[model samples]
Structures are given as structure tokens and as C-alpha cells.
Target: MAKDFAAMEDSNRSSNPSIHDVSDPARRTVLRGGLGLAVTGLLAPLGAGTLAGCATAGGTAPPLLGFKGVPVSTADAVTVPEGYVTQVIAAWGEPVGVAGAMPAFRFDAGNTAAEQALQLGMHHDGLHYYPLDGSRRGLLVMNHEYTDDGLLHPDGMKTWGAEKVRKAQAAHGVSVIEIEWKDGRWQQVRPSRHARRITAATPCAFSGPAAGHALLRTAADPAGRIVLGTLNNCASGKTPWGTYLTCEENFAFYFKGPERPDAHQRRWGLRPGDPVGYRWHEFDERFDASKHPNEPNRFGWVVEIDPLDPTMTPVKRTALGRAAHEGATVATTKDGRAVVYMGEDARFEYIYKFVTRDRIRPGGFAANHELLDHGTLYVARFDADGSGRWLPLVHGQGPLTAAAGFADQGEVLVKTRQASDLLGATKMDRPEWIDVDRDGWVYCTLTNNSSRGGAGQPAVDAANPRANNTMGHIIRWKEDGDFDGTTFRWNHFVLAGDPANDRADAKGNVNGDAFACPDGLWVDARGVLWIQTDMSTSAMGKGDLARLGNNQMLAADPKSGEVRRFLVGPVGCEITGATATPDGRTMFINIQHPGETPSERSDPDQPRRISNWPDFRADGRPRSATVVIRKADGGVIGT
Candidate 1:
């Protein structure tokens, strides 16, 4: 979801300590020596390979990033370095190859509600590639974060009814399509058994400690075990046991509540009305919060889906805790216990981690069906001494007693934000996707927090050094011993901004390319850190962010801190959701909401004014699509 669309208000009222409140010596202690040693120590178990220029286990090393960097691009087009080829594999409104329905995308923006469901959903976000046979054939699963109603309908909100609402709902969720590379290019395997769509109307089951909680029960489902949908699906992750974790982000705005909402509803960003301009509640009674308050609770959870099996129902793992979840990144402990790191993707919110108690069994999905159901969730609190601790959100522990409004573990997980607040967790700058490198270091993207150090807002902190942080930074940490360890040493990997800027705060310490608003993050199989930017449409070509040009993706050598622009997106689009084939030769990236006007809505009469990306048809509307990139010589991506 777009930054302006999500909750921008600072809801946290806790007086917890900030990292800047500590002594100056500790506040500035971003030691590189400590990080170097930690990375070197963990390398052995991860096959002890190379870090860009460092020697590998075989005493021979290859450069991690081998391509020349592309320059800043402002034109309404996709740009990449020389010797690279790009193709549009999947786009919004394209046929998803459902067994009975395979409707082609209408260039006139006239796809019917039934046709939209049969075709690809809108606003492609976090995605993953599950290989079936090496890199030649696989399942490409991606989620549609949200829909722009203006472009969805022919009249653009001039008419409203249940049919329009159904179309929008159908466009919000996950899409799994089997794609195969043959005869020179990748093509969708039509009528694939793996082809499936899990939309907002799809049936989903609840599991874990909070499954049967009273707060989740509604008139439609008295058992509290079943829900109708999963919307606002953002960045995703893949479990070692062959499942996809699609996070529910910015789910609050989907509902409309009474003039005065309860404290619980207000904390999760539910306001008095649809200030974000979502009109779903008008036609769908289930979205009316006053009639069904529990509906929002059913969302905001990490929903797991098995892309290989179309018959398996999607499950919302409640043990991971409810939040405006950004994405879930999974890393296994040395002992094989699964540790999942997550970001809340909201201002003044906290980062979270879940540690499964049992070691991962080896039977894929069968033996580990209940793996995520049994886990202990913890929130992070970064101290100023380059150290951090993961505080357990278990009920009756610390201040999480019954008197504090938490009756049991179920309530604690449902109201994870409040629980984290009471525990004095460190509030981050819109924490987004989190990724762990092969060397066992955890990295998170703290996309900009404009209110930091503002009047009546939280002040500058060591962990978040910039007040009114415009260009977001990436923070990383190495766990003490195990992936599930409670303690860890932390530091800033890079503060993103223009190195030539005159202002002290905006002049970030970037080693190479200048960029802003780091959002999507991925540490590839070979330990290359890929950073994608999501510059707000309002700030893209204006003022301080003008030099950054359009939204772009960059490749960075984590050890050397050398950043280089890899690709730039078309006008008014976000470069997000990246994945690669098993061999690393074929890479996929999604361009979301191209031609998105500054107002965040396109005029129905002139949908192509801003961009017509991928098609460039005179009558075509801007569509969110996946860009497939591969080396001309079929070498590994970014090399």
C-alpha cells in the first residue's frame, strides 16, 4: 500500500525511553569491527562463502555484483543496465488461467466483476517464485495489495452498488500461476492445476492461540474459526516447509466505523469514517464496522497458503501476532527452530519476531502443519549501546498482566500493538520488509518517518538518528548466538539520501548511488542486498526528493556498502516484490500502480495520461505488472 493511504498519524502515546536519550558516546556507537566479526563467525555454517571482495571457502572469490550501474531516470519508462533484457510476464487484468475461466484483459477498463476474478488481480506487491523443475518451470505467486477504484470502473465512482464492491474485493488478494520458460521465453502454463486465486471473498481458517478468541467471532461466523477473506496483502515470504506467507498490511481503512470507535479499533487505525476513500462498506454490510466490528480483527494477520496445492484452505497463523504486517522473513536457528522476523509498516509501530519452540520436522507441509501455531512472539527494543533485546509478549509476564487489559495470550496476540507499547518496545520509522542474509545477519527497512522530532512527536534517537527523516535508512543486527536469541548487537547499515546535499540531516552517508525511502529489501542467495525505493507520489519529483527521480531498485554489497542503481520504474509506479529462480539467472520484479497521479487516483477519461507501461497502447490503462529480467548471456542476475 501507498504511504499516504496507510495510517500516517502517530498513535503511540508511550513514554518509553528513546535511544537518543542515552549518553552521546553510546548513541553514536555504530561499530563496524563488531559487525565484521559477527558476520565472519556465522559464515562457516552457511557454507562459508564470500562477501563481495572477500575470499570464499575455496580461497577464491567472485564479485557479488558484476553489472554497471544505471543512471537516474525520470522518463516514463523502465530502464536497466546494458546487456540485460526485460519482459512483462504477468500484469493486472491478464488471464490467470483458472480452469474454467481465462478472460483476457480489456484495454478499455471494462472487465466485468466475474472476469476480474478470473483474471489477474490489481496492484501487484510482494511475490515469490517456487521452482518445480530447476529454473525452467515454477509457480509465480504474488499478492494484490489494493485497488484503485477510479481505474477499476468505467465511470470511476460515478455509480456505486454491490457489483462494483464485489469487483474491488475480487481484485484484492493472492494469485498463483504456473509459468514455464521454454522456446526462448517464459509463458503461463494455461489451465495449470496450480493456478488459483485467493481473494477477499475466499474462505480462510484461523489457527494458533488466538483462533477461538471472542474478539474474532462475528454474527457471520459464530465459531470464530472461519473468515471470508484476506485483503491488503502486501510483501510475502516462503516457509521452508513449502508454504507462502502473505502479510495483511493497511487493512484498517477497508472498513467504516461509528462516529466514535472503541479504544481497540482506534489503536489499529480505524477512524470515524472512510477518510482514505474506500467505499466498500457502503455496499457490503460486512465491511461496516458498527454491524460487524470483529471483521477487521480477522484481518491484520499473516495468512499462509500452499501454492502447490489448490485444495488446501489458506490459514491465518495467529501466533505471529496481529498487526499492520508488512512481510514475514523466515530464518532458521542453528538448532533448526524457525525464527520469523516481521515489520508492522506503520509509524511509531514496533518490529516483531516469532520463535517456534519445536525444531522443524522434515516432511514438508504434513509434518509441520502446526509449526507456526506453536510459537512465542516477541517485540524488539533497541538500546543505545548497539545492543537490543527481544521482549516476550506472553501474558502475565512483565507489565502484560490482566490488570493492563490483557486477559490471556489470545488477547495479547490480537492487540499486539498495545502489548508492545506497554512493554516499552522501540518505535520504528514505518518498519517494512525484513530479510536475513546467508551470514545470519538480520536487516530491516525503516522507511521514512516525517514526524520524528516534530512538535509533540518523538525526538531523534540513536537507532533512528534523523528527526523528520525524509530518506529512510536500513538497520541491521546480528543475533547473539542463535536465530531465536533474545539479545543481539545492532547498527545502521546505511542512511539513504543524497551525499551531495547541503543540509546535514538530509546528507546521508551513502557510499555510491543516492536514493530515498527504502521499502522492499531482499538478501539474495549469494548475499547481495537488493534495495527497492517507494518514493511517495507527492514527493517524487519535488523539493528534497527531486534528485532521486522516479522510484528505482538498487544493488548493494553489504560488506562494502557500495550502492548502485540497478533499475528505475516507469512514471508514478512503485518498484516492489522481487524474487529469482533457483539458478539466480531469471529475476522477477513488480511495477505497481504505474501512471498513478499525484492524487493517487487516475481519471477514468484519461487513464493513460501518466503512463501506459508494458503496453503503451493508445487506449490502454496503466496496469501493475511483473518485469522479468535476465542476462542476455543467461548469467546470474546482478552479475
Candidate 2:
């Protein structure tokens, strides 16, 4: 659903019918047995019953819910296993905070910027459930990836006024809602003190070596340490210290107006005009690069928020090295040091890891508040032989010196892509999300690369072999020893596509559970990997891609290389953001931007409405919401 430079460039070129073409031999070799064997070997150490609550009454773990996977569905409802039930917990415009008189979501009317800020933000993406006392009551922290202005405002973005723009800004950050499981259902706790919303207008602080860098200074905040808010929060993770790590993604589109173009703006894809059509410059001068050039630099970093303490301001952890960060998953070494794996979600972007200089302090949030502030950031370089190395971005480490335009570590992190270029890191296909298994294997989702094998694009390599990769794949690797090590072995777990389509990954899609564009990913408590799809809007329900049906979630057994479709989302939506209870009984997933079907004509008077999911009314507008799923027999999910 998120488009970048590749999408814009492809749209401008002459329509090439061969863009999605896949050679038969290439498709057959996409998911080689060697790759699957490598992944299976790495995951084999995770014996059965490793996942909590997975064992049956006889003390043997049941075979994963291979319950004849759900069929491809085009219906306007969430389709899960035969016994599972789904209910909408919270939706957009539902009041969250302690504000008086909580209002019900209105389909026809629009909420004010202040009201929207107090409600659940739009387009819920990556989410995690933190149990306050190891039970049902906990905080649900999630990211509002982006906004759909057409549905947010009464007249749409075409006639957006300052108020509409402000409301849009108020809907783009993160939401922390208090939820509880009661009477066999999960529901939101309205007006709970823990229920708070952090919008783009909220104040945030910078931490780490790059905190006070000159590149981050802005007219509004000359100190360079204080930023107004976070933007484009896509995928997220929870830390060992109990804080939430929300990643900023696709933030370049929010800024415009640099009188003269520079390397920083060009590298980040910021152009002269509004590319994705959010003309924030029209309302705030800070959005104009010419007026506040350094403002954009403050974003694109991993933001840390302490959800337990609502009064505490979020921190932009600059030590993580900034980019279009899709998400950052944290793992700890035996020595208790924090190791975070992050992916830059853009075509030809590189994956990165950050290892803390000090081990995490035992005393919880207050004692380990600044653990992330001191970490060595490293970019990954994959080799053709299935081995890889981590290249540190420290200034003067190798070619990163004054001659290379990096004076200090702060500068290297501020321009992380340039540093990675100097280090010759492998350019990957839109790396979206990363999750670590109980066996310490790291998995990353490469969400397709349409530009591969094109005239001017990067040639296919062993890691990314497909020419025009319409269907995405997942790449996994193991650290040399543990999470803190540098080198590792890697392989592709699955190359996703339509099973009936001969051009797709036939071997991987043998069971007819064809899926494309793997995006949001999570490794649950039991070591089962859950993958969510984000098929392009233009490809969904059409041609070869249509056979896969709507975007869906799948459960995969890493050790056995067995994948089964778990749930199919409603029409015109991407199924993403998954988390489960500690006992692994109930699972929560976010269905983002449902019913987002685009119109073929440019008729403003008669806008096309494809679906109204969750609240299926012919006249109702579709709103993104969190879906809570549970088994009818109260058994562990996926088993």
C-alpha cells in the first residue's frame, strides 16, 4: 500500500506489459530445496512445544493448525479458521483518552483535529499487546502508518483547509489504548489513564550522539534536541526494558519546498512538489525545506516510547542510525546487551543492526532508560555464498572519514544511506519487517522489487534472483553465535506467489495458499512465524494476482517449512500487525486501510466506493481497526 520512488518512476515510463513477466525456469528455481534446507536446519533446534501453551493434555504439542487452510476469499469480512471468531476492538475516531463525553465513530461527519488527536489514529499498522499484570488488562501500543485524506475529510484533500491539514497531521503518529479481555472478548477501556494518543503535534526529544547535531536544528527548535512529533510510523517492536520501538517510514513525502535541491533531500526522495499529495507546506512553514531544512532530518529515526508512563515524552534514538525504518526488533545476548535488527523499507535499501555498548540494567524502565543511546550501528552485506557481514558505521572505521564527508558518528548516522553506500552494503528489495525466532534466527521480509532486471536497475543476484519480482519473499539468517555477533549464514525461506499461476513460485505455493508482498511479520510466543501481506492496490483481485484473493495472514512452521493460510482480510485491505497473549490463546492483528479500492475515473462528483468493511453499510465509510481473534474451543492458536 506504500509506494516510493519505484512506483512513481514506473508510472511515468511507457507502459511495459513485460514488467510482471517471469521466466519459467526462474520461477522454478526461486525456492530451491537448498534454501529451505538451510532455514530448516537453523530452526530445527526449536523442538516441539517450545511455544507456550502449545502442548495438549497428553503433554505433546499438536501439529500446527494445518486445518485445511482457509480458502481465498473476495468477501467483505475477516475469514479465519472454522472455529475462530473475530471482533473489532477499536476503530478510528473512537475516543481513547480521559476526555469527557466519548463520541461514537461517525461515518458521515468528520472529527475536529483536537477530537481526532484524542481518538484512535487512522491506518493502524504494527501493534503489540503489553499485559500490565500478566493477564487480560494491558496496553495496546500501535502505529498509525499513514492517513487517507479522501476518507478523513468531508471534501477530501482536494479542498483541504488548514483545519483539515491539522487533523491529518493529528492522525499520523501512534496510539496507546488500554484493552482488557473479559467475557470471552477483548474490548477497549475508554477513558483509562493508560489510553493516550501521541500525534504529530506531540513534543518529542532526541537522544544519543546525534541528538544536538546541527543537521537536526530547526527554526522552531534551535536546540536541535526537541522535535515536534514522529511521522509515518509503520512497523514497531517492544523492548526488553518494556519500552516500545516505533519506526518512522516514508517520511520524505511529508516535506516540500527546498529552493535549491541538495544531496540530503534528493537521497531521501524529497522533491520540489507534493509527490504523495500531502501538501503540509501549505499549512506549516516547517514543512517547507527552504524555511526549515533540518526538520526532516529529525524524523526517520527509531522512536522510543514508555507506554507505562504516559507523561514521559517519547525519544528519537539516533544511535540506531536513521533511514526509512520499517521496524526494529530487539533481542538480547547471553550477556544481556541489547541487539536490535532494523530494515530500511525501500527498494535497494540495506538492512541494519544496532548493538548496545552496555548491557541492559536489571531495574526496568527507569534504570535502563538510556540503554539505546549508546549503540554501534551496523549495516548488513550479504554474500553470494550464503554468508554475510555487518559493516559498522562508525566514523573513521574505514572509508568513513573527513574525505568521505563524515566528520563524526553523528554525521554518519544522519546520512546513513551514504555511509552504507561507502561500505558497499547489499541493496535489498524493499526490506519491510524483521523478527527473531526462539532459536535466534533472524527473518526479514523483502516485499518485492519491480525494478529488478530492468535496463537501469540492479541485476539479479543470488539473494535477489528474480528479474521483475512481483511476488515477494522472506530471507532469514542466523547470527554467528548469538544476537550480538557480527557475521551469519542466510537463505530465502519462501518466495511467495499465486499457486495456479505457473509464473509464480510453484514449489513454495504447492498447497494453493498463494500470497504476494510479505510485509508485516511477527514471531509469536511459540516460535511460529506469522506473515502479513500488502499486495499493491493495482494488482489486487486482478489477473494472476487475483487467484491469491485478498491480503491474508499465514502461519509458518520454521522447522518443517510448512506454511498454512490462517486468515484472509476484508476486500481492499492489507492484513498486518500481529501479536498474541502470553499464553498464546488469543491473537490480535490489525486490518489496515480496508475498502481502499481506487477509482478508474477522475470524476470528483462520483467518487468510487469499493467496500465498507467492519461496519458494512452501503453508505458507511471504511475505517481501519484492530481485530481480535480467538479459538472457539479456547485452545492455543495455530496448533
Clashing pairs in 1: none
lDDT of 1 by residue, 1-639 (tens): 565554345653456655455534333633331122212233222332443434556877677778999998888889999999999978999888888789988887788888888888999999999999988999999999998887888777887888988999999999999999989999999988899888999999999999989999999999899999899998999999888999999888888876888888888877787646688888888888888989889999999998989888999999999998999999998889899999988877889999998999998888888999998999998876677899999999999989999999999999998899888888888899999887777899988888888876777776787888988888888899988899998778888889789885787778888899999999887788899999888888688898789999999887777788999999999999999998888899999999888876665334536787878887777889999999999877877
Per residue, candidate 2 scores C-alpha lDDT tens digits across 1-639 of 354434542322222122122222232233343144222343334443356555668987678544558998988889998888889977888887555746666676367887788888988988998998565788899999887777787667557568987898888888898888877778788778887789888999999999999899877888898999888898998998898999998887788847665766777776666645676788877888877788889899999998988898999999999998998999999998999999988877789999999999877789988899997999988766566789899999999998989988899999998888778787778899999887777899998887867776666765676778878788988889878788988878777775556663322442335678899899887778888998866777576677788889988877666678889998888888998878887889998888765442112322237768777777677778999888888777776
What is residue 568's positional error in candidate 1, in angstroms?
0.7
Q: Least accurate stretch of 10 residues (summed lDDT) in model 2?
A: 11-20
Clash count per candidate: 0, 1
Off by over 4 Å in 1: 11-26, 29-59, 603-608
| Residue 91 of model 1, lDDT score | 93
Q: How many backbone overlaps does candidate 1 show?
A: 0
